[model samples]
Target chain A: MRKILDKLGFTNTNTERKTVTFGDASVVSAPGGRGWTWLSVGFFIILWCLASIFEWINPIFWPPIGAVWEQFVFIFTEGYRNFTLLEHIGLSLYRVLMGFFIGCLVGIPLGFALALSRVMNRLFDPIVEFFRPMPPLALIPLVILWLGIGESAKIFLLFLAAVWIMALATRSGALATKISKIHAAYTLNANKKQILFRVILPNALPEIFTGMRVCMGVCWGTVVAAELVAAEAGVGMMIMVASKFLSTDIVVLGIILIGVVAYAIDVVMRYLEAKLIPWRGKS
Target chain B: MSGLSVRDVSMIYNLPNGEDVEALKHLSFELEPGELLTVLGPSGCGKTTLLNILAGFLAPSSGKIDFDGKEVLSPDPQRGMVFQQGALFEWLSVEQNVGFGPKMMGRKPNEIKAIVDKWLSIVGLADFGKKAIYELSGGMQQRVALARCLANEPDLILMDEPLGALDALTREKMQGLILKLWKETGKTIALITHSVEEALILGNRVFIMAPRPGRLIKEYSLPFAEQGLEKNTREIKKQPDFIEVREEILTMIWDMEEEIMGRQEGNNA
Candidate 1:
């Protein structure tokens, strides 16, 4: 918090001062306290509710706030399709997590190798370059044809979206390491392994964390698209069915829920990045 | 051979355009044991190139560097270098920075701690051990860098203008500290500097270099650095012999600079 306040260009005064969260990753441009966020959000909801209640916009176009809230409770109490709301969210999270987990576990090491070794970079560079500009949505038709719209297909899409991010992040992080520090380690009689693990890896972590944040955002954006194939129970599937039936309130609810969850994941990532790489950005 | 020996070393840098620039030309010198030698030169005199070769960062195109009678192949704990700036690991605390060498050599944790403590105190940074390297002032950071190198117990300490970035007062204070450390440790020191006063005050044996295929042009055997251990560097500089040597080296370097300038203009023409 002190780091954030200090970073916001606050000067020390003789008078007492309040701590500010200026650069809170979750809270953008928040000057002093969190009151503005809640107040603004409440204001928006009220405006939305009044417009819906007065029929300023068509109910089919933008459903009433109260209607969306009731649908949320209905989804929880009884079930959406067969499983409850929590289960739908849980199943979606599982697929994203499994693919993202495996992709990172394999891709990060490969990225390290690509950055560290000329041979590995040469071998993998063309492939990463070729696939980099293509979005995961472009592969959906092929994924469905190959994996038959199963859970594997969705997970694979998420993995394909995320793996390249991790690889490139690691490569950049390794490149940003200072040659002077490496030479300092060498003069200390450090072997190749010691320099690689101790000197190179720690310096690479901040960039890797940046990569992870981006990967998670990409995964969330693509999760809904991936689940559009034939997911049994997910927010994406719920939105798809509701839109088809013109259940506009449920569609709004699903979109809002996805956004809220993605924001929550990003906030958690900011906290972890702060903890693991406290030395980041200072040097 | 008992100290460090550089036998007729030369270096050539092949630029991307298929042109070769001679950075160093047949540079030969020896650093006797416990000698404080300062290599003084103009900007393009290849002082850094000489230090890099001595520290085993680069192999000379033509000659050999022998440290304690062994041919230099790569950086070793026995040959420690302090870079001009940003030498210490920014991530490590001062204590960990000093302990890094021993840690890499797989010393026991307690032994590393002991060495860290000893060098930290010697460098007057005992209280700063827990502090991060970035938090220190430039002078303090250089002290930590020196402590870090000395923690490895190197026989030769190569300082590539270690105090070049400091203010005048801090440079003077650090020069005093260098003399004190040289007296205390009896380690062979090869200090590179563009400041003639610094070279005269800290070096018992000084090598003056000329640029454009950099090579040693003159050498001086002086008593000021030895006297600096007991007297003030300012007072030592007041001596007639010290004044004479300063003027002589100053004129030599001025001539070299003019010659290099003429060559540059010629190239332009």
Candidate 2:
């Protein structure tokens, strides 16, 4: 156990022995953590290949990784349903972007205003709290009924999903700008406008960035659900379409694509958040 | 007429529990231009409350404060303040924080630069102008705070225990630097501290306040601040009068604090 722990970099000769704990699973060390993650994935793939090769599980029911890879290539090359994979990805991205952009544009300004003014916060807080808990999927039928299956209904649904997240984040950020900072600015002869823009806004950027990341994540999810409302193209639509034909491989492919794209977006947002607000919690 | 005049300035706060808490009571004083006045008191003596009133951040419940015979009703560029700790805008670079006062006053860029450079250099943070506030030590930050306040060229500057957070050596050094600046700039300064050494060493006119209904309990005039400029702190402190005065004031404050404790205990009984 000590040797294994030493090998995993969790302990050395100079330090006290300790168990490496990851949630409920305790191990000797975490040098194994990275290896374990890859090992598990590799193990699952090997099992899948063995099962498919031996006809242990019917290929139709549980396709091998090779089959899924082949289907993924096919979808990339021959297109899926009425739209190409690229086109499907692009369309979904555009709708989500548009909705997220609108949410930031409208919600951020409103949020800053709400944060600054107690009266405005009092007035809108109840309404915002009411809508914030609501899922975009729950609003689909009403949105579709009101605006039909056009792009407007879907876009609005995505907007509704994202706006509250961003607005709440922005509100919290602005409201939480340190009271001492405000006092400092005031004592420096800063008027109300200077205090609001210079002191309050810069300090609030980190929280707003956090809000945007959360808002983007929600927008991605909501766009997929919104695509369920009579959309011809989208990764969400591809998943829906493939599942209808029991094309489990295609469904798996679509889900993977969505996950990869969302992960990529999260990486970009994290990078931007760091670059834009380098002093976020440094102070 | 050129200096500040506080007449019968009092503050009364009605607590939520149907109790009237008088933070300050008819505190009247005159601060001559270019003179440094330090108020020394125990905790809860409304030292800070009085500073806040003088800053125009708080309106006196009664009476008035006049700066050059102008009613001081609100915070103005001519009245700058230095807080004890974490008052410097940590997000801003040292230069930005120092220049903030001039920038707010709509001074020309060149003028603001000159003022910022002068004050920053005066506070011995000449090389640290590009550094962030968080990058500085406690002493350096207070130096920056002092420079930031002085940059405004405020007719009067208020400091609330500005060196209270510094180490003893740093605090002593800062005291001398403050005196140098006071002599150089000739700005009226109203400072609050709990240190008898600090109050005696800095103020030509010193006032001590009583706890509870915070009133001016005692006042003194001394040549120590001037002597401090020409002599070493130890030399000045070695004087028999200095020792006697320090002990006298300490005893007064100790007695007041004990009285507060006794009353609390009596209530508990």
The TM-score of predicted model 2 comes to 0.90
Tens digit per residue, CA lDDT, model 1, A45-132? 8899789789898878999988999999999999799989999888888877887887788778878889999999999999988876
Worst 10 residues of 2 chain B by lDDT: B83-92
Chain A alone, TM-score for each of the models?
0.87, 0.86
Worst lDDT 10-window in candidate 1 chain A: A9-18
For each candidate, give the TM-score of chain B. 0.97, 0.98
Question: lDDT by residue for model 1 over B1-269, one digit each (tens)?
Answer: 58999999999999999998888999888889999999999998888989989989999999998999999988888999887777777778889989999998889999999999999999999888999877889999999989989998899999999999999989999999999999999999999999999999999999998877888889989999999999988788899999999999999989988998999899999
Q: Categorize the docking of model 1.
A: medium
Q: After best superposition, candidate 2 residue B38: deviation in angstroms?
A: 1.4
Estimate, for each residue in A1-283, the C-alpha lDDT of model 2 and write its tens digit: 8778656544535323545344523344423335456668789888988887887866556666777899888878898887788999999999999899999988888888789989999999998999999988998899889999888887888889888888888899898886766777887889999998898888788898998898889899888877755788998998887778888888778888889999999999999987777677766
Model 1, runs deviating above 4 Å: A1-42, B234-244
How far residue A188's Cα lies from its native spot in candidate 1, in Å, is 1.0
Give the alpha-carbon lDDT of every model.
0.88, 0.86
